[model samples]
Target: METELLSYAFSGLLVIVFFISIALAFRFSDGHVRLRKRLKSRLIYGLPVGSMITIVTVLAVYLFLQGGIHDWDNPVVHPFRSWSYFYPTGTVASGFAHGSPSHLTSNLTTTLILAPIAEYIWGHYPDGQGGTNASRDQPWYRYPIIRACVLFPGAAFVIAVLTGAFSLGSVIGFSGVVFAFGGFAVVYYPIITVVGLLVVGVVRTILDGLVEPISFAGVTSTLPGWTSTAVQGHGLGFLIGVLLGITLLYHRNKRPRIFELFVALLIYGLTRGLWQIYRPLGGNEFVLYRALGVSVVLIGAVLVTATVVASKRPLFEGSSVTQREAGVISLVAILAFLIGPGIVTNLVIIDYHDEPADDELAVEDYIIGYDENAENPTEFVFDAPGTDETIERTSSGVYVASDQRQLWIMDTSQNQLRSTGTADIQIGGIGWRETVTAERDGLQVLGAQSVYAVELRHDDQLVTAYESNASTANIRIDNRSISFAPDIDDRFTITVEGSDGVEETASIPSVNESVEIGGIMFRASETNGTKFISAERDGTVTTVAQEE
Candidate 1:
């Protein structure tokens, strides 16, 4: 796991421990009434239910992790199946395999956030006494803590399982419940339609952060690329949110009129048709989809209009709308809906059509190079005397480019290929290791995979090595230390304070981007205040120092 992720793991473990503590907590209060109330509020979000579900989920996951089964495709039946037949206490894998800290946080937070709200909703065990509702604005429902404790977490488990989310290690967030909330809200959307819609969008975006992209026929899912950030989960969440919104709408209406259901479908179809123009719709798929949309909308509109027009009479006039009139109004609304969604959709089509992928390269200038020999290519060097790219070096050492993408650390010493970016460096017996991290993990062997190795006689032999504060661009010799600059020729000043209390600062004017100090070499990108030249391959960067 990455170090950054590990940094956040402690908090995640705390959450897990917290849940276990809650489950074991005995409800021993002053009396039965007091005990009931106390336990109810404490585990307010159906903690018992959530804890039970999450414990099972966590245990199953622990088994997979312990068994070294990280990938989802390779099915590893967890202990639950085994407990029923094979073993009693099941199994426990030695090493911690719940992934990094970020992973833990994501999963834990999901439950903490969603459980309470879901439980609150499910707590409808009425006390058989109606609260004051003289001229009622809102109906009252009793909050039954126990019932909520049972259902909310149960619902969450069901959602998580159906989505194939909890089983897979990829998604680790509470967005599923958020989606369910949106779905639930859809049942009451018409009353506060705008607020309802916004809520749905917010929920969708939050959940989408952890799910697969919506892969409908015409929906290309350009949402991620558009953000220039990898948050496809939000897009998925948002889509689920849309379904939630619809659900809320349905619920508010209370037993959806069949005609209205068809109308809603019509609106969806028309919108989809408009989406197809910009997105990839296979051969007859486009025409077929558009035809369906158009047809559905037209039928829905006509039906709605007929219903609204036919239901013109309220027997007790002005008290409320008659069912027949409401139907006619719905029919008219459907006609309008069929036309409106497609119009807005068509506009989106115009915006997206003829456009390239969101991830298309937009850089104006760039420089790319590789090992010419392609055999034992370790380091790359550039030397220009006139270019006053004053790299801070007592004695001239090699400097390679950094930051502007590709990194080629040439072992100018003996042309030995130390390691690439993604290889894991394994350490067994005493030995020195030379390794560099590239794009992804190339060597994923068990334990620590070695990028390069040097002989160390004993197992615990200590090898003194310096971890650079910055990326290692080049090495420069000071009296005793080595320093580095940003690139081949960068003016980013690096100042070194020697052991003798003497400070020496060097400034490269142009073309000499990197240099070392004492024994430490700073990587180019992280070299303080360094920037690459406009002509990246122009061999040097200009150093315009404050003094000069």
Candidate 2:
């Protein structure tokens, strides 16, 4: 519920900002852009105008490929569903393909607003009140083409690898590329760019945190909603842009004072360290590491600001930089930044003695047949295949069955079936019903049709510890604790197994009733038929619309 409120608040903030930007844009457009107007029209508008044109062209091609604009009959032709673009093809298709009209428009809007601003800065817009003449003949790397060449490939590659590695579903949009524009703007126009990107980042982070995720094949994919696509990709894209900006600072000057070099190194390290704390792949966050990461970034930002402000006696002070040298440095820096995380991830996985297939292998395979292939082998697995029957098994050889109107448990040891009443509704439509199953050695939990069941594995015997009906809108399992709220009720329940292995339930009043769970006190209420859940945790009160 808190998540929903944050979404509304962020949306409201964007609407307000949208109007403010319009007013500011017109106010600033009082015809004083000699430098901007002087640049080649293509250099000034290529990214903004070209990107929009490409989006529309791709949409037209997509319609032709699928026989209609709304034709989803052949999802293989859809960029987001196609495996071809998940890798090398990423360079060609990722930027042009968008999921919907709104998706395309959002990217177009941001690109139009931020890209032109960045292009002007790259064109060396004379700010009049400058210490050093940024108007000094710009290098080739500073040209729009070179910057796009570097930014597009770098951003696309990063997004592709990240989604391929961590995400089960595919994503295709220009959000990541739009973020790169914001990134370039930050170093070139710190005040405006930083503030703008920060607001966007915060809003996106809040939305990502609020959504419920579906666990499938040992991977958690967020259920499609208002703000789930490419959430982490935005973070990565923005990070890449910032890294490029920092590289440019060093490229401008080779010789520097000891203190200046120290500051530069500090900024670089802190930028990396900050990502370490909240990187795409989850990292263990020891308190000390997190604190130091944040502290370094803050200090680095201050030093960077100071250095930029004192441009005459800059930290990386050198006579001049050649175009080729700057380009090489930029390429190396971007590649290294993208590669470092992969190296660390591999090392960490190896150190922890973890294998990629451990989780899936642990889940018992109820295979009925197998298809052999030299390149990629396939195993045909069996389950109760029907709209109403879905079966899952545990590593300990117990099967839990969820069907319409009743829940069934079958013991492999005795080959017996136990049935219990369930609130499994006969709902129609794709989003109407959902199911998620998770398992451990002695535990298997199935959530479906607004009901959840827990099966305890005991010597090939399945023991039903708890079975109940609740809302499927929000169901979560952490170790032995299960948390959920019923769609029809005003309270949520937390069922935790005690030391004796017996299940106990605790019901906390919903947001309207003002109750506390896990130290978060909230009130559940209805306003004009819309249910809202407000939760207070760590002295912050967050209210959100309850999703049913």
Candidate 3:
């Protein structure tokens, strides 16, 4: 606790130092005159009301609605993810909800740094930008407070809902909106946006290092880092933001340099892993198309650059439509093409609502089970014609499925549990949350298969969910074979079978102990950190089982 407090203090001090350095640099720099002028004018008019509201609302949703106040680390996350179009709660909340405190903090931090910049570009007082205004006419809706408090926030909310509704699958985070803020700021202040991205990274690194000053870790199995990213939602948000930024810039009769916009978009896309275009081959397998992704991002950057920097003159000598108008139409068409697939995918209803399997545990709307390799229902939920044969999805390990939420995901894989021996699965909704712990206990025989059992514990109830087949060692001792099997009470039992129909079974003895069964004495012994079982009968000794 003392270490943690000191770490927090140090982290806070670093943040303060960073901001002070930035302030000093800006104060002395000649290039910051425009920024100073903007700030001076904006400060007297109003604050970044829309940005503050968004940050507060996102934090409130994560803390209160997702039950993060009590358990900040392990909040109710499954129910808040955008699962299906039919589930209104998930569809709406997923945009604001976060999977973990780290996720929430990172997104809020990005927003804190970039949102104000975007809002600054979109000034509190409209001056023929974003919307039309009559000359010297002050409309009631054109008030600074109205633009800052009402219009901006309202636009943000609508965008959030749209992002959540059109996201490819169950995604939970504020990152989509964060990307939107980045996209908006990049149009007017491309260099500043990139610098802000770097600052956000540095801040996250500092916080992480402070939280964990020293660490100990071992090798563990995990999927590719990009597999979990909600690329579709992020792309949609960024495109929308760019569109809005360009529209505002056009209305205000201003345009950024073409090269600057292209470079900024390209750099941001590459750094943010937007170039990771992947498809889940299921069973913890995924395939990423690096070349295709890079090409797509490059083309997208070129198109956006063209759209923003196009001349107002007509596209051709005979045509009335200007190049800028044609560019805007092309962008709108692209956005529609991007959104149409998601809408079709989301419209499909879940069909696998059968009763839970015998070995599966049922808790309210959730069904938990352990399986080596089972057909993943969520992958097939959207039965796109001819795609089933191409995308065969399978899952292995402890999984939780819910028909209502249209969720079927492997929480922990079989290999992970075998190495770690334990996992906790969090499941719940709205006002409540619960954790189901899965434990793997077993003994592996040398040169043979392992005998094991998978058990789950929730509240006071303990269930042995799965038991593997008994395995016997290949070696024999005095015409008797030794076999190991997992018993009901979460322990291994040893069985000795003789050639003349004589057999005996007994619980495996503890270390440095011996048990006699059917005239064969089985002794569990350890030497030089190696554990092995040996049998002695009629002055004959032979090795039987050993830890693998």
For lDDT, the strongest prediction is: 3
Clashes of 3: 0
lDDT digits (tens) for residues 1-548 of candidate 2: 87567666766776677679878987888553654444444343323333334345545544543233443322212222212221234224444455554455556555555665555544422222222323348665544544444544444445534433322123466666666666556655555554454455454443443332221266554422322444334545655565555555555542234454444434434432332332221111112345754664565455444443343332244636544344434445644554443322211100111221211111121111111111111111221122111112211223222112112222221111112221111111111222122221111123333333333432343334333454322332232333453222323454444335566545545435765444445466777754555546567664522423
Per-residue lDDT of 1-548 in model 1, one digit per residue for the tens? 55445534644655566567655564433465564563454344213454456545554553343332343332222211111101111111101123333333444444343333333333333232222122335333223333334445455555543232211112233334444443333222322222433444444544443332232366442332212111222223323433443433333333444454444434432432222212223211211244543554465435533432243367366758875546535544533433332222111100111221231111111111122222211111222231111111111111122222122122221112222222222111011212222121111111222112121112333221111122222222333332323222232345555668665555432334444433333223313433332111124432212110
Q: Assess each prediction's global lDDT (C-alpha) against the native.
A: 0.31, 0.39, 0.79
User: TM-scores for all candidates?
Assistant: 0.28, 0.36, 0.87
Q: How many pairs in model 1 have backbone atoms within 3 A of each other, for residues 3 or more apart or on separate chains, i.e. clashes? A: 85
Model 3 agreement with the true structure over 1-548: per-residue lDDT tens digits? 97677767776777788789999998888777765566646532335778998899999988888888878887778888776787788888888999888888878888888888888888765662333333457776666667677777777778888888887766788787888888888887888888988988887776776666545689866677788788878888888888999988888888887788889999988887778888777555788999999998999889889989998899999899999999989888888876865665565455556577767777889888898776677443556663443323575789888888776767888888988789988888887778899999877775689888889888886777788888988877777777899899638888888898677899878889999987788898988866777778888887777654
Query: With candidate 3 superimposed using the best TM-score fit, by how many Å does residue 249's alpha carbon deviate from the native?
Result: 1.2
Better of 2 and 3 by TM-score: 3
Off by over 4 Å in 3: 1-37, 43-46, 128-140, 216-221, 352-358, 379-382, 385-392, 500-503, 525-548
Error of model 2, residue 127, in angstroms: 15
Q: Which 10 consecutive residues of model 3 have the lowest summed lDDT? A: 127-136
What's the lDDT for residue 320 in model 3?
97
- Lowest summed lDDT window (length 10), candidate 2: 367-376
